[model samples]
Target chain A: MASVARKNLFEDIPRFLVAQAGIMFAVSLVTIQTGILNGFSRSTSALIDDSEVDIWVSAEEMVNLQLTLPIPAATVSEIHAMDGVEQAEAFISRTTTWRSPTGDIAPVQMIGFDPASRMFRMGQLTEGAIANLQEPYTVIPDRANLGALGLDEVGQSASINSLPVTITGFTRGTQSIASSAYVFASLRTANAYLNSGLTTTSNCQLEGDRLTCSNMFERDASDIALDPPRALRGSDGITFVMVKAQPGQDLNVLSRRIEAEFDGMVAHTQTELSTLTRNYWVGSTGIGFVLGLGAGVGVVVGVVIVSQILYASVVDHMKEFGTLKAMGASDWMIYRIIIEQALWMAILGYIPSIALCGGLGWWTFATQGITILITPGTAVVVLGITVGMCVVSALFAIQKVTHVDPAIVFKA
Target chain B: MVVSSLQSPVTYPIHSLPAPAASSSYPVEHQPRRAAIAADHLNMVFRSGGGSYPALSDVQLRVPSGIVQLLMGPSGSGKTTLLSILAGILTPTDGAVHLLGEDITQMSRRELARFRLENIGFIFQGFNLFPALTAAENVELALKTKGVSRRFARKEALDLLEQVGLADKAKQLPKNLSGGQKQRVAIARALASDPPLIMADEPTAALDSHSGHAVIDLLCRLAKERDRTVLMVTHDPRIIDVADRVLYLEDGKLTQTPQS
Candidate 1:
């Protein structure tokens, strides 16, 4: 071979430029990935945290939490009696407004539940203690109600439905869809205040091996001039029942069993509820869909950018390739130059892209309380995608240059 | 015009030339199978939108052992086309091109590309140096493309640059060089692989008279000093004196007289 010492910069400079482009593309992809994942995780977390039970058994007709159906209260007792089952509770949710301590009131969704159940008290406490919620004389206000109730701590009282009740505790993350205050008190307290005619009954009985019961509220009853001593459940109407599964018992199986026993009620597992909430938001309007679609578009743009950089570099160095071809360099040798450019770009772009995306993800999460779960697997996949884009682009660029006639160099 | 030694066309069939005549001069100590370059009745046709134009018609040539030959023609006289055919950049419409007695015309596009990379040296007009590469790097690229180890090819490229009197300009880009200097770098690139046949098209076309003469001098001297065969195409008459043999073409046919 003829001995000729050439410049070493040729090997490094083009590669560096290509890699810089790849980094920009990869960074954009990471941002999109982080944003979408954060939105999804936050929505799921909210849905799960608001539920009243660890496990919920609903009828098969209800896809998720879109609609609530009433199950006979006897089903709750049956679930509570099952082996390995810790506890079961019943609750009803309705949108309403109550009198604040300062007299100005806001719209709220009051959740009526048994305060004694540990599973129902998992919502984060902002002040005082849930123990103050021992009797009918008290109400636990959600965090959003704190300012208006003039309640800084326990022992402060607030009024609902013209009945004055003490502010036993304050809990965070209890907003029920659209920042509505979530007032948690006994079912009796809520039914009496709302005048919903709900009542409790002892008509619980067993039909065959399964327990069967009906709503306890009296029929054909007139509105009383005075408040009832305890809350009543209307015979025809009630909301949802929360069922806790026994240890080692499959929730799916229990859910199916409840469906068979009482086909009118809808049951859901915790994970199912979380997924349903995310799906609901994504399906409700065009904004969520558009954001997801925008992320997809970002990926395509990234690939094209990578491809164009490699192609341009190849076109610029046609003569160098022709010269090499005349030197008895194989086509593979020419191909390596182009491929190396892309590979280098992928490597350079990956670290900074991931770092940028990760930083952006944390910032979004902190400010909006969205959950962006950036796992190593996702990073690796994004890196692989960048590399793949580079390679495809390189292949095309190399194809064009390798065919350049060495005679053109001569003609020059 | 320079006259032919023979009164009538010599026209001796190429096959009648002793086989060893083509092989005897190459410095093949171990690998005697290496054939530098060969062509037989090579014909090239170009298809324009109007009709087909014949670039070469039954042109036959050979560089045996080590010899320097010149291809001279006016513009559009097909000198560049024939050179391109020999270097495997363009396939002859009819007839065969052999490199080291192997028929390159019969090779596939892929195989022909391999042949060009292994056996040809081309010097184009304007030197065609890569703008992004320094003088030394430009030559190293040739060796690197051929799968030569970096350490070995780097040393070799530097040596070839020194041979062309540009060892000091190895780090300079093409834009930084004078007309003659870039041509010299091109020459270094041509010799990077030490191929047996160098086909150069107007190597000194862009240079001043003095620089042009200097480039011709180096081309001739290098071919002779290294015992390598050279075929340079030019219309310039100044370097005709240095050519061991000169063939002229006019309107795609071999001509007996120079226009001047």
Candidate 2:
């Protein structure tokens, strides 16, 4: 049948375009808010999700991977002895101050891991970057943070906690998500830097606002024996124990055993640990709450404005609806026509909204050094919201339509 | 349009009716007049914030097939209200209306709508043409509502427009048409579904005298040729000469009744 409902809608082209614009405004607001929130979640849990470990043993009451407390390094040996454990490695993650060459200080998240362990998958590394980290006092910072660290090239010198160090090579995909730089160091270098506490006691002197180890500067970085700082470490501690399970091993069973074997320790399978980190960052911090609130407001405002548009459209052609009713059009058929209009608006409006969000995400990632990832999963969620919003608005407009008196056609 | 014989089968019960209404236009002298509309003991009361007000008082009317019956009354005489009840657009406060042998007042709103779609057509005073649709499309909407396919509805709408002497204006919108031309479109729309009965409420009230007479003449010619029963409510005396009978209302009461 030729759709009288559809003809009535297209009869007013300018008004229809205005309705589409309302739909566009609503969908875009939701997409942008949701995309930004997704970015925060992804950034907070990137490392936990990237690591292929079956279990992670963190400090007592460990809430998030963002700032893990120190657990005894000896706990690694205990975990390695557990059944179903294929391998275990010590990991250290901390947010510490990094002083740029020009004396500009900023926070950086430093991670120390064994190069041979498969428990972690360090993102794309430069050629020979891993082998080069074997030398003492060498650190590889992500290339994305080069401008912030005030280092223009590789081998550039920087200081962490007054301990002099040189940038060995650059890597990608390791940029710290929490508004800071990300740097990778070998266990040998991290133990020298992290376990040694705040100060370097070995011939460390401040020279023109730049900390330089007099003994460390004399030998080339390739010597590998010039760093006497590692001997100054007093205690052995690591923030996390990354555990890999044997093939066909049940991670739940292994995690339960690790928790049971050690006192004041928590064990989580890979997915559990990742979710824990994500939830902690999003819930414990006020930033995630603010972002979620913004998304909620967008949805509400979208609903109100879009419903008004739909309601106004219904009001505008109410006479035609009454005419249809008088001519024996069923309620369901009339409601179906209205729903089809909403569906059309939802699809047409959603495409441009997501495209706009994707563009905004790329622009911010490029210019502000902050990632706003609009992944396929995020797009799918936003699409659901957009379609649901329009349909709800359509149902709202139908309330007015249902009250139309078919006798009104006689009035004129 | 296929015209049905006035002698078609008497499928409905013949209600006792007033002689004048039953006598006006019986085409067949021997055969009983098929009743297109039979109403008994109708009373319409409209209630609002002020109070309850009676609009029609115990009105009984039986309109036979193939006749033009003009319902005449002063303002607020319930002429439109009675037509609305007979058309099943309004349910009487206390009465039963049987149109085409079916009791419309007893039917559900949905069933009434279905029955109206198949058996009745309407033309209103202001023409009531959908302003957004062209003349032919406005007529096509009626055919489509009757479950006619798009291609046939379009062709039938044009053919009906041609019958109303507005074939050249079929593509014009109502806003661009004259009062008589728009009325012709409304007439075409009423005839599109080929219904057995047509109802018009002051259909010529907005037109000038010449246009009003022309509109009513075109309507009566179509209704008589197709053997359709037409009940029109109007105050326009110029068009009353074309009616087979003119029923008058005064203060919501019928002034005359004669048994046939």
Candidate 3:
């Protein structure tokens, strides 16, 4: 059977290669699209996945990390006091404007965490230390976006929401799928930038028996502080309270406890949070559907092209097959021969396709800084799909062969 | 004269046959000739969109083992149909065909395929060699289909090709071979399985007189040397002298013609 398949493919090299080209193009398309989408989904949740905390406490109804609303930083203390809780620290993420060295404004996702607590660690750094973030007005920017953020060197200074900050270090591979540059800073520095212009005021308006106090108002130099607001201020109102479970404590149990005990807040384990965030970006934005549709189209095109090619080959070899049948070759033997041909095509087509796709992935990443991951698992899965595609196509050709009458060989 | 159609189990008298030719390689007393193929009331009807056409009606045949039997008929005379029925390649609409003493018409398709693989060798008019395979490889494939090991099949294929005087062209593909050489390769393939019964349909139809006579001579010699039953269909009168018996058909009826 192997000899037969090899001979047939070699006999018409041009036609065989044309068939291989169709399969290869389809496979490469599918691999590239799926690889990029997978890379994007992973990047969307990289921050949460890379964090050191075991559980995340965010405002209720927070769909994704990027859209999280600020929760009262006081929640950290409450979470710290709960049973099975080891430690809790305030974590903040705000998409704020950065004033680049060129004085151009660009959006940066500012991540602020406690420098003293090990609840969250900075991303992979190419330069400087994580302790440097403790310095006042200091930050670490992703190296991939140095040009976009206009931070030429480690000591270069920039501004986040008009607050001057020095680029004390650089992080690598922290670029988000949103194309927003990431800046890491201390909790205090982020709070100063986040709550710069807003002040608390007790301007009460009365109507009927209800009295409403409007404390949020813009501050001006002429206005005097009438009284301090009752609620905590500044860094006390942070985006999230990241918590770690004590040794021997179950994260799911701790998360459920926090969710049940706290009001106006939700608790999720690290994996849950990452999945939720990834799903929000992928499912809510319809990116999953679009990418899936692309892969589906590739598979369908591959099936059609391979089926047509195989069918044509079977037609051309109809006399040969009929001769084999008349020569006492069983139906199973003929079927095996055709299936072997299909398997050969799949393997031969996939080898070059994976190589080409790997090159394309590298080129795309090097040029655009958009990661396209072609992992070993991805290769295995793509190969499986390729084999399946060819086998299914061969079935159509097998049907044609099975119906051929061996007696036809006797005809003129 | 019209021969009576076989409607019942009737015995055929073996003693009525003439003495074996002196040139026969096998002596008559040493071999007990048995019927290699027998058809009883074989009827074949082809159905189509418009109506059904009867190709063979109430036809019967018997070819003795260890002899070269030739079947002669005009075009559309149902010779190929009868050969296909006897080879278990097709089942008649009614009646039974016994090849090598088993009722092949009663066998399932899968069973019939296996039966034919082990018992019959077929040579087609078109020579139907796989275009991509070399001449020896084509013959080797038939041997492999009969459960011969790869190495042994290759050796046997070469030997069979040598028997048919095609050993020199063993490495050449069918496309590189001439029409007569292709037919010889087909003959080698048929003999590869070493089946007890051999069937050929118009084996010399596409060849010139010299090639046709050569092919017929090879078929006759190979059959007589091995004492294997050979049934061939031919329209050429030039090869009729080589047959041990000649069966003639007209309008699907069979009559045994005395050899000149």
**Among all candidates shown, the one with the greatest TM-score:** 3
In candidate 3 the C-alpha lDDT for residue A349 amounts to: 92
> Measured by TM-score, how close is model 3 to the native structure?
0.84
RMSD of every prediction: 8.8, 7.3, 6.8
For A1-412, candidate 1 gives per-residue lDDT tens digits of 3222112223456655554765576556655555565455454346355554656765445544434555555566666776556677766665556776677776666677776765665367777666655566576776645654455677766666555667777775544333356677777666555553434576778988999877666532533333433644434233556777667788787766666666576567777766775666556645465765666666677667767776776776776677666555677766776777677666777777777777876775544433455677667666776777668767778778866776656556
lDDT of 3 by residue, A1-412 (tens): 2289778877898999899999998899789878988878887888888888899999996878878777887788888999999898888888889998889999998888877777686668889998887787788988778878987799998777666778899877667776478888888777766664456778898989999887766654422332221233534678788998899998888888898999888998889989998888888778878888898898899999999988999999898998788766888888988888989899999999999999888877655657777899989999999999999999999999999998888898
CAPRI category for model 3: acceptable
TM-score-based ranking, best first? 3, 2, 1
Let me know the TM-score candidate 2 reaches against the reference structure. 0.81
Question: Model 2, B1-260: lDDT tens per residue?
Answer: 12233222222223433343332222222225767887877889999998999998877777777778788888778888888888888889997788888888989989988988888888888677777789998999888778888999999999999999999998897889999999999999888778999999899889999999889889988998888999999877677678876677767776432111
State which candidate, 2 or 3, has the greater TM-score. Answer: 3
Error of 2 at A153 (Å): 5.7
On lDDT, who's better, 2 or 3?
Answer: 3
Q: For each candidate, what's the DockQ?
A: 0.36, 0.39, 0.49
Q: List, residue by residue over A31-113, the lDDT tens digit for candidate 2.
A: 77677767777777777778888888997778777566788778887789877888998887877778999999988878888
Can you give the TM-score per candidate against the true fold?
0.72, 0.81, 0.84
